[model samples]
Target chain A: MEDPLGKLMPSEVEFIAEDAPITITPNFQAGVFLFLKERVGPFKPQRPMEVPMWLAVSLRRRDKCVIHVPEWLSVDALTTKLEEEKMQQKQFVHMPAHFQEISSILFDVASQDVPNSEECRQLIQAIVDVRTAKIRQGGLDDMKDSLAIQLNNVTQMEITSIRQFACHAMDAFNRLSSV
Target chain B: MSYFDIDDILMQEERLPCVASIDVIKMGSLDPSSATPYLRKGSKVDLPLWLIKSYREKNGEDIFEVDPPKFLGPKYLDMLRADATVINLQSWCSHFFSFAITYLTLFQDGDLATTIQDSFGHRYLVILDISQNAVQDDTSEKTRNLDQLERQLFHAGLQDDRAQQQWRRRQAHRILPWAGAPRRDAFELGHLTKRPKLSFS
Candidate 1:
């Protein structure tokens, strides 16, 4: 009966990912602004400083700063990761727990700042496709007899996406086997 | 099961083949064909699972002998063993797994439970694959033959698959208007109070 709705909504996940750190260079001088949960920035002109993604997005919208795209979301880095994912077909490749949410949200808010943003989006989509296909195709073998499986390097986004189906399947399997 | 579980209530109504080993007194209404004042010895009748269990509980266990239903018998087991994936379990019984579970409780039958587990083990992945990939397609045809429990599992998988795809498409953030929400122009300040009568036509 618990988890009837089964995991957070994608928007809620994006909200959680907002707290993750990003680098931003402000165009205008502003003193430290204190938010409810965290304090951010004595922003100086032409100087790079660490800030949360939400703050960067807000600042970018106001023409106050430009976001510095993270290295992992770069096109070249993602291409390398995709190759590794394809090479190691049997195992999941490690990523940030909220990479999917972060990447998508960044693309939404800071596409101009991110170089080769479209190619990066496509590469990230391809990586997600490859991983999901692996799960759907071969990942079920280990679950045939056991309730638990080793989820090495699997991300929170991946886990949440499949949590509903996996939980229901395992519950049914458990009921049948127990009988 | 809780008092309000409809599935448990329905499963309890599944009739079992029961033979009265000894004369049963004042229970003749259960069998319309019996002419005796009380149920006579060696009378065969199909009784609901609840009645059979009640007899076993309220009275001694010797009054009735419950024969294993034909569906769980060797013949059906052989059919199931031959090819479980192709079997139309719904045609045999509505609540097949639940009924089997109840049967296992009343009579400790390891073989029955094993057969069930094996069939489910084979079919579960196929159902998962179908539900996961068949977005926008009519899956009722595919799920028509599944047992009740299996059908529920298929639906669960289907829902999750669709949810992930929807979130990926950025459609998860659209807030639908509530059913009874007030309209945007529902009550203007001017509309709430009496408007001054329009001067000059």
Candidate 2:
């Protein structure tokens, strides 16, 4: 009855969150040694260095760095991408599992640096709303013909919402099959 | 003659379904002639049907009584019906069904047995529908493949003997005296060991 899929999804999200890249411009002209077995640098003021999103956020929090928003995260690009995805109806954009969380963090901490931040946030929210509604409708449609359910592109958070029900259902099926 | 063997069914019927009649203070004192020890009050103890029948004939008292399995009652079934996502449903169902099936074999109460069967069947179908709904909304095959790979990696991590052994070795190294003091010993013998004299020239 152990759900391998349920357990793995969160770790995958964490891995993606840690690995996502972000750029930061240091305010101070001093080297900050990281305990992660590497040196960040004797930072030059206004020179941007690319690091993992987590390290960038930490540096930004400590007032040590100003984040440079990635080009893909700009309002126009994301809005266009969101629109395209909605129109295609067959494929989701290639996004990290923790995209929403990372975007929220960027929106919260580095709003001034990001171009058209409010518009970007609105587009992302609208896309999320559309996707969630579609997911619910798909679930209802699949229930009509029990044999045709095929799961794909489900976010980790979405899986977590229904994990308990899925696990119990699978366990019941296993018991019935064994008998 | 049915799907189950007749001799097996007959043997199951020969066993008595009885709860203890009274509190047995001393196990050795009561029923000294019998091989088995006396049971405490409220404990269910099955005896041979012939022994219970003959004892009832002599005493004219109903000493042995049927104690229906707990899951055979309405409470558990109602809970299962109300909440499919109830915690520990897997283990609970397995335990209840095993006991209920054994109880059904011993006592030929058709109505109770049929009820249990129907309850299990209904719950199973409900679970199936829930699972179907959970997986219906996926939008891409690539994410599904990634999910499969992630599951494989997670299981591999659980079963990786080399990683487990390396972790144990690292823990053992941490506990050793030399591992902790190696840097400290080198630091003490280094050039910085000498104290610098403070003087304004």
Candidate 3:
């Protein structure tokens, strides 16, 4: 509600995305604690348990847990994804809908937990750059004269990035087309 | 155009070259130099769009044959057709696209509308590129030629780009609260209880 522009802030999108589940190995032993609705833990030493990203980040920040990087976030996987993204001229590779947010959070909070963190970061950056360039170069030209443009497998951040331009341009096109 | 749209009102104030096809009575003063009380047949005058609209004939034929502004003429259109990205749309008309659309709608010229759409497409790409990359850089010269609508579109893209940059630097939020929220630190001593009154005495 505080956002007057009626567009979600990047940080706000990150906040919503932090609810996606991630696996973490907590160092401390603890029984299940009632977190809002569902019970959350039974944290035992070195036992990887799936929990919300928020919980994992909290535990990692306090030196109580090691976040297990998701399979897609690994260097090998992201490299292949980056190559796949480049190979597809007009199609967006299907990524975790919350890939940008989740990756940013992981890199910020638990880079040490993941092996080859630097390479993984670089690979993710490459994937994002290639994808963004594809969207700009290929997706936008198809937008002319049409009321709606199809963009399958697009992520939330990618959509957010172009939301203002897309909406305004479509409105402008519709106005001209009404003649 | 909507009643409260300031841009439409401003555009309507811009004059159009028009010629009276038939004799017009008691409207001679519309031309500043005319001494006669009645406008003579086949008289030429520059009239605002609003006045031209109000002077419509009962048979639905335009009382004044309006000559489109020079910007919509073949020369300017040819220039646009060549490369729309280089044209200074603001100098030609601050509301260039809007005026073109309105003119096309009124005249029912299908081809002119297509020309406008084509130019818009070309200009949109340039605008998108400029706005997305101008991050924290001075782009005064780059954006100087943009028309009002295009300028708004540029600003929209610029804001999103700047937001992403700020977010990456970790300067976008004061405190990264646990996982979900950038906590605002809502609680304060004053919010819990009333403050002591300041006495004048």
lDDT of 2 by residue, B1-201 (tens): 244754324433444456667654444233435444565566666665445545666766555576554445577656555653333433343344444555555455766655555555554443333433333333233123212212222233222222223322322122223345445455477834643221111
In model 3, chain B matches the true chain B with a TM-score of 0.79
The residue-by-residue lDDT of candidate 2 on A1-179, one tens digit each, is: 34555343333344456557778887777655443334455577889887777777877777778998876677777888788768856455554566665677788677877788899888877776666555545652333234234447756544443454444434433333333
The global C-alpha lDDT for each of the candidates, from Candidate 1 onward, is 0.78, 0.52, 0.79
Using DockQ, give the best candidate's number.
Answer: 3
Fnat across every predicted model, in order: 0.48, 0.00, 0.48
Clashes, model 3: 0
Identify the CAPRI category of the predicted complex in candidate 2: incorrect
**Candidate order by decreasing lDDT:** 3, 1, 2
DockQ of every candidate structure? 0.25, 0.04, 0.31
Identify the superior model by TM-score, candidate 1 or candidate 3: 1
How well is each residue in B1-201 modelled by candidate 1, as lDDT tens digits? 477788778878988888888888998877789887788888889988877777767865668888877788899989988888888888877778878877777777888888887887788878877887876668889888888877877787777777778888878666455579755455464443332221111
Model 3, B2-84: lDDT tens per residue?
A: 58788888877878899888777888998777799877778889988767766653447667788888999889989999999
List model 3 lDDT by residue over A1-179, tens digit each: 01235766677778888888988888788877555435677778888899888878877888888888899989889988988998999898999888988888888888887789889888888888988888877776667746888888988788777777777777777887788
Q: Best by lDDT, which number?
A: 3
Give TM-score values for chain A, per-prediction.
Answer: 0.93, 0.73, 0.92
lDDT for model 1, please: 0.78
TM-score of each: 0.85, 0.45, 0.84
Candidate 1 error regions (>4 Å): A1-7, B53-62, B174-201
| Candidate 3, position A172, lDDT | 79
